[model samples]
Target: MPTAAFTTLGCKVNQYETQKILESFEAQGFEIVPFDSPADVYVVNTCSVTQSAEAKSRQTIRRAARQNPNAIVVMTGCYAQFTLRRGETLAEAHLVVPNPDKLRTVEYVLEHFPHLKAQLEQARQRGETPVRRRSRAVLKIQDGCNIYCSFCSIPYTRPVMRSVPYQDVLEEARAMVADGYREIVLTGVLIGDYGAATGSGGPDLAELCAMLTAIEGLERLRISSIEPTQVTDHLIELTATNPKMCPHFHIPLQSGDSRVLKAMNRPYDQAFYLELIQRIRARIPNCAISTDIMVGFPGEDEAAFQNTCKVVEQVEFCRAHLFRYSPRPDTPAEAMRDQVPEPVKSERIQQLQQVAKAAARRYAARFIGTTERVLVESRSKLSGLMTGTSDHYLQVEFAASPSLAGQLVHVRITDLTPDGVLGELVALQ
Candidate 1:
């Protein structure tokens, strides 16, 4: 059988698209292999979220080429669009699929490389359809982002706003549940903008979640990442009260400084963000609130950086994805005055990371001695012990049978680890 390899970068949206693309290739009798292994074809779902991401994307493409010089290297995703915008050509990429047309990458590859199609036709394919591994499956229900955050390039790359039809979403969710996935994470560029951008003409995000919980085999539902402005009371209540909903919220607080927020054209202020968190905690006790924080934005002085540190201490996020701001070409923030030096950005990131880690520890410590529900994923690469994510987003590791990999079980949090907490198996839930 013809072999294929794939890798994805950036966000969950890219991952969902890559999964769909992989499914398409497998349906065409392609034998999927590891990206590092030599294959007849290689697809790199690239990201241009930051300059570093772009560099990594390019490096990944080059690595694919080195793996098999004769292989067809395909590049699709945000960085693909960025490459075209920069008027640059990647010699290693034989097929450069457009970002918006990423889902159709397999078709582009098959059509261009007829020999691979002929090879697949000659060999008998034995794969009994590829099952998405483990328990959690990401379902992309919405596409395109219109928020246009000044520091962000996603809106530029994915300008169209469209929600997957409710029926289609329901069908996919049912199929995922049937495929033995216990948890479904709903992902999108701006997921909270589900109905508004171009109107789904059906259920909004909260209503969609309500509909999804009806799927019999789906043990959990999670909203990957949402903006602070989009968390409505109805959604909060559903997440707090719904038995199937994971009590973890990934709301991106790009910057905690009100001045930096305004400069970045964010709608909410510091007070509004803090108030929102307060309301969330009031409704859902011990809910894990995770976030993405960007450091060293233009004009983010010591006072502004301290303001961000204060919010990190205040919210006590379960996890915070701390990244330094990098100027995307043609973005508003790129031309802004007083761009913090790289040294300052690095220092602030280190400082913020320390504060964020402390806050996360404080958040995780609350669950010590409490029995939390976890969908046992797999063994830890570092600890070699069974590790899985708790309902509240803690990575709980404990001694367990390999047979219990995909089941929802209870783990009694015994003590804290550096990342999360070491736990003991309580009972299967």
Candidate 2:
């Protein structure tokens, strides 16, 4: 059988799309292989959220080409579309599928190499077995963002807003649960805007989540990064009340400084953000809050950066993705004055990382004596122990039977590791 390797860059939406694309290939009789391994075909679901991301995307494509000189190298996703928009091309990519046409990559592959159809015929003649993948799966229910954040290019790349139809989402949820997936994480560029434009008679994000949690055998549901402003009181209540809801919210806090937030076109300011976090924590005991914090942007000075640090100290996010701001072409911030120096950006990132680390450690320490419900996904590579994520989003590792993988279990937190918490298996749930 023909072999294909895949890799994804950027957001949860991209990761979810890549998984769907991978399944499409597997359906066509291609054997999936690790990205670093040589294969007859390679697909790179690229990212262009930042210059570094695009550079990495290009490097990944080149690496795929090097892995198998004669292999078909495909590039799709944001960077592929962005590159063409700039009238540039990646000579390394044998096939460049547009971001909107990403899921059709397998069709493009079969169209390019008609002989692959014949290869599939032979593979089917031999026989096959379907394999259930990861215990937790990501299901993208919405797409596109209209926020037009000053520092983002996503709006330009993925301007079309549409929600996956109501029946389709629930049907997919049932299918995933039937496939043995214990949890479903909903992802989108603007997930909270799920049912607003769709007049599909579908439920809004909160309602959709409630419906998903009702699926038989589905143990957990998680909502990927949502804008702070879009989070509603009703949604908070649903998240807190639902036993199946994973007590975790990945709300993006791009910047903590009000001035910076305003310049970034973020709807909420420092006070509003603090109040939102406070409300969620107050309502849901020990709920995990993770965020994204951009370190430098045009006109962000020492005071603005200090305010961001103060917010981090206050929120004490269980996890924070720290990144330096990179100006996107045609975005408003690109033309703004007073761009911070690269050295300053680098310096601040180091400082904020230390602060974020200590804050996360403090948060993890709060649950040291408590038992957490963990969905055993896989074994930890570093510790060679069974590992999975807790309901509260803690990465907990413990010793258990490998056969117990994909089941929910209770783990008593013994201590905090550098990455997450080390635990002992208490009971299977």
Candidate 3:
């Protein structure tokens, strides 16, 4: 059988796209292998979210090429799209698929690599079953972002706004559930901006979640990441009340300073962001609020940086993704004055990371001794305990059998780990 390996970088949206692309290849009789292993083909879903991301994407492509010198290396995603848009090419990529047509990457592969097509045809001709392994699925219900945050390249790359039809989304969710996936994370570029704008005759994001929860066998539904402005009150209430909807919110607060937020062209101010989070917590006690924080934006003085630290302390996020501000080509922030020195950015990153870590630990400490429903995902490499995410998005681990990998079980929080909470199995829920 023809072998192929896949790797994904960047956001949940990229992960979802990679899954779909992999499924397409599987249907064509490609044997999936680990990225480290030698394979007939390699696919890297690249990201260009930041300069570092672009560098990592390139490095991944080169590594895939080195993994199998003769293997066909396929690159697709934001980085690939950016390179192609500039009339440049990645030397390591044998076949570069653009982001706009990423879902059809398998087709592009077949068109570019004919020997693999023959291998797939021969495998199918011999009547072999396609390999399929999935426990948690990511369903992208929306795509494209219109909110042009100055430091982000997503708007330039995915300028259009589109929402997947309600019927199509429901069908996919039902199919995934039937396929034995206990969890489905709804992902999109701007997921909260679902419906109306794209002419999809569908309900809004909250209503869509309500519809998705009705799918039998779907034990968990997660909203990957949402903008602060787009997270409506209705959505908060639904998440607070709905058992199917995971009690986790990944709202990106790029910067906590209002001046920095304005510089980034984010709509809401720091006060608005804080108040929104407060409202969410008020409705849902102990709900996990995760966020993305971009540090060292242009013109961010000590006062502005301190303002961000204050917000981090106040919000006490369950998780915080800290990013150093990287200038993207053609963005307004690229030309802004008072660009923070690398030394200053590094220092601020350390400071913010310490604050964020402390806040996360404090938030997690509250749940110790309480039982939470956890979907066992994998065995922890360090602790040898089965680790999975709880209903509130907290990472909880406990001693359990391998057979319970996909089931939802109760875990009583026992102790606090550096990154998450350790727990013991209470009972199956």
Candidate 4:
């Protein structure tokens, strides 16, 4: 049997797609090996989310090539998608299948090693194991993005908003639940904008939440990252009522200044975002509201940057991802004249990041002495510690063994650290 290795980079959507590809390869009797291991084939799943991500993708591809110089090197994902659109030469891969139908790619690999066909057939007939082990299973309910935010490269790399059929989503959810996964994070390029396309008379995110909550044995369902504009009243209401849904909202607030937001083509402004956050807190008390902020956007002046800082301080988010604006090729922001200097952008990112860290510490402090339900994910690599996530997505660490990996237990928050919450595990009940 021909051995193959795969490496993936970037978002949960990419990770989910890579998992599907891996399953397909496994079914074809391809012995899955580590990326560092020499193999007959190596697949590098690329990412173009940021310049760093693209650089990493190229680095991984080169590393894979070095591992097995004679092997067939295949590269796909966002970087390949963007490069192909630009008519750029993809020299790394022997067969550059640019976003080829995933299943077809697997079949192409199988054809080269026909002797493994009988084993592949047997594996397919037997089916995958029911109880698979995973700390967190990403369930991609949607794919692609429609709204072309000026600063984003996603719409170009993953154009259009396409939702997985509701029935298919339910089936996948059920499967994950049956596989002993305690937490299923609903992920996508544009998760909140799910069901907007296709016009299939399917349920919106609120309905999807309700449906998933009804599924028996599923301990938690988390919304990966949602847009501020997509935080509908219905969705907020559903989250308020749904016991299974995590009380953590990560809404992307690219900029606080309306002018900056308009330049970036983001759908919501500070006032609108604040209102949404207020509503969510009003309904779901103790909810950890988080956000994504982009500093030094095109046309962002001192006032605009200060405006973003003010909003961040005012909102006092539980946590925030602060990013310095990096213009992607073919995006509107790249064409704009008033791009901030690198030093200034970096300084502002640091300032905002400090504020976010402070907010996170404050949020974690509130949970000190409170008991929370946490699903133990893994034994900590540090020492005899075990780590897990609380219902509100706060990381909790305590002493545990490998046997408690998949169990949900109540933990009393004893200390608040900069990195995570230190907890004492209560009875396993």
The segments of candidate 3 whose C-alpha lies over 4 angstroms from its true place after superposition are: 1-3, 31-41, 62-73, 85-95, 107-131
lDDT per residue as tens, model 4, 1-429: 567788888777777777778767765567776576898788778887777678788888888878888888877887877778888765666655566554356766557545446655665577632223355577888878878999887788678668888888889989878867777888887888777455324888888888887889887888989988888888887778877888888888888898999889988777998888788889988788878788888889989888888887777777777767788878898999988998898788888888778777777888999999898876665645888888887889998776787788899999976677999988784
Tens digits of per-residue lDDT for model 3, 181-229: 8999999999989986684566999999999998888888999999998
Question: Which pairs of residues collide in model 4?
Answer: none
lDDT score at residue 24, model 2, on the 0-100 scale: 92
Ranking by TM-score: 2, 3, 1, 4
Which residue pairs collide, candidate 1?
none
Q: Return the lDDT, model 4, position 179.
A: 69
* Alpha-carbon deviation at 365 in model 3, angstroms: 2.4
Candidate 2 vs candidate 3: the lDDT winner is: 2
| C-alpha TM-scores of all predictions | 0.86, 0.89, 0.88, 0.80
The RMSD of every model to the true structure, in order and in angstroms, is 3.3, 2.8, 2.9, 4.5
What tens-digit string does per-residue lDDT give for candidate 1 at 124-190? 5443343334578889988888878899877886799999988889999999888788999999988
- Tell me the whole-model lDDT of each prediction, alpha carbons only: 0.89, 0.89, 0.89, 0.79
Lowest summed lDDT across 10 adjacent residues in model 3 is found at 127-136
Best by TM-score: 2
Please give the distance, in angstroms, between residue 317's alpha carbon in candidate 3 and its true position after superposition.
Answer: 1.5
Winner on TM-score (1 vs 2):
2
**Candidate 2 at residue 374, lDDT?**
96
Candidate 1 runs further than 4 Å off: 1-6, 28-43, 59-74, 84-97, 107-134
